[model samples]
Target: MNELVLPNDTNALNNLMGGRLLHWMDIAASISAQKHCNRIAATASVDNVSFKQPIKLGDVVTIKAKVSRTFHSSLEVRLVVWTENISTGAKAKSNEAFYTFVSLDENGKVMRIPELIPETEEEMQLFDGALRRRQLRLILAGKMKPDDATELKALFFPEI
Candidate 1:
């Protein structure tokens, strides 16, 4: 997804507003999730988002998103945002985020989706780390006990 950072998308400092950027990222991540499952997906959660660089008004912002991993009914989408200078045609990464989406049926019930088979080395790394990240998220949300996070526990206590 590509967006022009117009005045409406910027704050008083003439940089893109964080909220507006988040909205754009959600749309982009949702599109990737929907395309993967071929079903309507609802955002379940969004990880912390940090802007690495200020995107000024008139800059072109490009967002690239892909499914990092999939659980039974939910998938994680990784998104990278870049800002381009129109005149110089230079582009630099500005932000990155992870979004979780749950596929839904017409009745709005959660539906199972196909799994992701990561082929590349980068993909394999992300796929392997997804479980630890998910466990941490669940633990932080109070949905799972820290002791139950086997993958995460191993990181801190390798003997166990």
Candidate 2:
């Protein structure tokens, strides 16, 4: 997904507003999740998003997204945002985030999603790390017991 940072999308400093960038990321991530599942998907959660650099007005923003992992009815989509200067053609990474989406049927009920098959080494690494991230998210959300996060526990207590 590509977007032009117009005047309305910027803040007082003439830089793209964080909320506007987040809206674009959500669209890009939702599309990736829907494409992978071939069904309507709703955003379940968004991981922390930190802006590394400011994107000025008239800059072109490109968002690349891919499904990193899939569970029973949810999938994690990784989004990378880059900003390019239209005149100089200079490009720099602006933001990166992970969004979780759940597939839904026409009745708005959650539906099963297809499994993700990681082929490359990097993909395999991301696939492996997704579980630990998910566990941490669940614990933070109070949906899972901290003691039950075996993968996360191993990171802090290697002997256990």
**TM-scores of all predicted structures:** 0.97, 0.98
- 10-69, model 1: which lDDT tens digit per residue? 999999999999999999999999999999999999998988989999999999999999
lDDT of 2 by residue, 1-160 (tens): 9999999999999999999999999999999999999989999999999989999999999999999999999999999999999999999999999999999999999999998999999889989899999999899899999999999999999999
Q: How high is the lDDT of residue 91 in model 1?
A: 89
Q: In order, what is each prediction's RMSD in angstroms?
A: 0.8, 0.7
Find the 10 residues in a row with the least total lDDT in model 2.
122-131
lDDT score at residue 136, model 2, on the 0-100 scale: 90
